[model samples]
Target: MSGAIIMLNAYFSPSDLAHVKICPSAKWSPKGEIVAGINGKGSEPDQFDTPYDIFIDEYNNMFVADSLNHRIQKWPPGSTKGATVGSMARPLVGIPYPTKIFVDSEESVYALDYGHDENNNSIVKWRRGLGNNGTLVINEGIAIGGLCGDMDGNLYISDYDKNEILKWSPGSTKGILMAGGKGRGKALIQFDGPRELYVDGTHNIYVNDEQNYRVQKWRPDHINAATVAGGIKCLNDFAVDMDGNVYTVDSCNSIVQKWSPHSSTPITVVNGDPSGIYAISFDTYGNMFLCEGNENRIRKYSIIYNDC
Candidate 1:
């Protein structure tokens, strides 16, 4: 059962927007048909005020994290769709700066509030229709901006300022250090600042390891330290496919590279010059969804199987 890799067509609107910019983060729906992410428009002279973070939900609902506008918008899955859901609070629902969002099986929304004030930064979880209900509070000087969850219902947060990952269970305040804290020596490590995280079926924790320019894997049971995947460059967010092959968004390289535990070199599976990929993900069926930041769109790549 060998697997083949190939780059597919890019997805975006040419008539509506005309220009592609930067897409920060992207997520695939549980059903595998939709994708959502942040679309940053104009980096230089243009100065387009279109910084919309989109959410492609299971039902194909697109939610945009409009940062500068101070709101989250929604775009339903259809031909006649556009952004709908938004943070209408006087000052923007206290979700000042949202980095990422995760929706559970129950449709509950979990957003990472980088926070207006560094001291007030927190991870907010809101019920489907009930708006923002406080779940876990990090008021004690702990700022949570990135997040991921495990099979057993435990939540993992990337503490950028602290340069570590904190483990939080249901109704728990005290978090255990999963990786990169003060005691850990800051090398490729000891992340200069950690970003997003992904937990696999085997309980392996994959930290973005952002500033380190690679991804780090660690086991909950074995917390001695973290291991690098293959010394990637400018790794944004990485995801494990159905077969456990690791795929990372190499922004600097403008391509999505695939890695394996046995391989030293990563193979480019997708390419777009200066694409500026912010996130990468895989659906249950093995399809790859890339958040092309420079293109301001989410493109899908089918993993072609072949004898390797």
Candidate 2:
């Protein structure tokens, strides 16, 4: 049996994704451009209260998990206004607080409705038609933190309540334990509070151990997860480039840093923001998008330096 590391993600593989300008050695512009949200808090089409996650689709459209607003907003390229594309406030779905989101190739939006009526935590999918009464992918007593899908359509979910990761095959009613079933701890086999995970092509899981302030990579069928990046200050979201370089936002200090596989410490990427950057993502052009939670703005930082 040949055992080799397999690198993969929902979007692209590690080996083939570097040409778009996302590299560990690259530097982003010090200033950020307002791509979404009007620098104010409101329920208007151009405003946001607390945006938690950012998902960039294949078409370069940005999908935001508007946590406080309890909806998902889809903003097309060069658009200042966004459409309310997903929600859990329908008469049938009850009131919910959505926290994380992902957009598939078909542009369907999937959000983790963290709490609905205090007990109905679920993953809801809003199809292309954009309806409030979205289809429930998983529900009933689950405390969801984050979720993502693989090429095979399998869903990987992080359960904060159980401190574990579960994999739900397409059409399956239940999720099988994939990692971190030993309760919450700092050990490699445990998750203090897991959030925002991505499944690579070779089945390795890159998970954000939020409370632990680090990123851990769980290889396929393995019990221990190796820390990819550590010593972060309140890391809320992260993105890995095709070269396996990890980019993270220090949510508390408003700093951004990059972790290369060859370095023990991280290189500061950005600093001096509004001090509440909650999420991060990279566009096809290698520009950076950050969700400023306190400022209610999606800030875009273009690539200012590239070694390649």
Candidate 3:
């Protein structure tokens, strides 16, 4: 097959929201359309309130951590409205404040609550289909900045306050310090405000060192982490695709960069004017989705590569 690149532009809303546009490229592959949420801001099911994070499952369903509303919304592909899967105002039981969400292979939903009260700020797990209430999994004293799971169901959390990453086994009471447990610093073994993390199939952990404006990768038995990419204006969130390619959003520069494994430099995937990207994720089909928090919209980008 011959390789060719195509660029297409599509407008979402017919009104002022027309500013919300999808620019698709063959190499970068953003499907020229708005997959979920509306362009303008609102609290309705079709809208979002400063959506902090997003996770797309194997079935193309999008689960959003609607931070301001304090709820988790499940948006099926092509649907205008989403179902409130988890919320702080659930009738009998609910999480007080939910900041991030992760969906495992079994479709289990894991949410990180930032803690509104003394007993808050923990990790909650809700089994597949049991969306009403969640069970507390990890309840540490300090708040958790990021949460991710590996192939073996092991959980990894980034404690911003402690400046470390904790690894918790399936049923363990407490987590073992995997990296950066020692105070905040710019050393190889230390981290300053580690935010989001991603674990690949081989259990390699990749963390966004938010304060340091860099991304670090740690192996299973490594004592220190190697910097993969850095020098971005502001690093907010990141995602790793099946091929081990790393994608991260730089909020300050308003662009997204793609880095190959062990590569120090990155290929600018999403570049140009300020978009205010708060989060980034990939679907099963390798499509990239960005959460434009300031614009209050979710944009989709489909990647297509043809081997000639």
Candidate 4:
């Protein structure tokens, strides 16, 4: 259940459909040739059922949110099989359907459940080495689309129903409105279907305004958001590297673009691949991994650059 290592020869090139230009001094390439996945792509223990999100921990263990499977599978580095870390079959009160999974600095796992019980969308936390079941952290009645954590262990969730983002401090029961509590709009303070988000060390939030077709950057404690990148169709997810560069996946265009801070234009890193990518993430080594929903596989890409 491993993926193939694809070596892309041209870093950037001008084509009839998508124009890409590679810098003479710098280029992009793949790293070591270790690509792994489940046995085929299904609901079996060794398979994945429409994985929507993935998180790599400090020890290089990967946690995948098997959305349709209603479980989270933990795959150790270099291991072929994965163990179920969290699942709806666990002793939980309601039907816990996990949509997104986030691992904090302490290796604690948090999942955003769809709340099939009474429409009580909740965020559950599971400490490292603990059992499958998680403790309820936030049980507010809101439709959550994405979940991410800051460096200080604070959690941020995107409310698709409210068209806003909610923030929850560690050990807090209730969540406060961080942004977009207003109705959906194209304004600076509103969000129309805010799906995926990433919070940096400085507490600044980068959210994918899916329906608005733009990615927004909201500074700490700021109500107004500035558009970092836009004009793409159907932005699915985004990830921020250690250097503050933002990478976003466009479903409609079938490409992933890299946008430097405050830059209007984006450099095309991942070319147009028609697999229907649903999520994007970065590991500790700056390697990028994307979850292709249709292909039922996760593709890894390494970044190569220079000072110029």
- What is the C-alpha local distance difference test score of each model? 0.53, 0.77, 0.72, 0.69
Top model by lDDT, which number? 2
C-alpha root-mean-square deviation, candidate 3: 10.7
Which pairs of residues collide in candidate 4? none
Cα misplacement distance, residue 172 of candidate 4 (Å): 1.7
What are the RMSD figures for all models against the true structure?
Answer: 11.3, 5.6, 10.7, 9.8
**Over the stretch 1-308, how does candidate 4's per-residue lDDT look in tens digits?**
11111112211110110112223233345332224453557877667777777777656677788778778888776667678877775544222567778876555667878756534577776665766767666666767788877655566788887898887665555678888888989999999988888776567788888889888989986769989888878787777665566678887777888877656788877777536788776555555677776666666776576334
- Model 2, 1-308: lDDT tens per residue? 11111122233222112336465567889989888887489989899978888888666888888888888888999998889888756643532777888766566677787765433467777667746667766774767788887767677888877889988775567788999999899999999888888876677788899888889999886779999999875888888776677788887788888888788788888888655888888777788888898888899988888776
Q: Rank the candidates by lDDT, best first.
A: 2, 3, 4, 1
In model 3, the number of clashes is 7
Residue pairs clashing, model 2: 8-200, 8-201
RMSD (Cα, Å) of candidate 2? 5.6
Please count the clashing residue pairs in each candidate, in the order shown: 11, 2, 7, 0
C-alpha lDDT of candidate 3 relative to the true structure: 0.72
Q: How do the residues 1-308 of candidate 1 rate in per-residue lDDT, one tens digit apiece?
A: 11111101211111100111111122222222223333335322112133323334445444444444444555444332233233435442446666566554444555666656664466555455655433433444565657766545666778777788887665566777877786334463477667777776667777776666667777767645445464665776676643445667777777776676556576666665336666654433345555554554554554444322
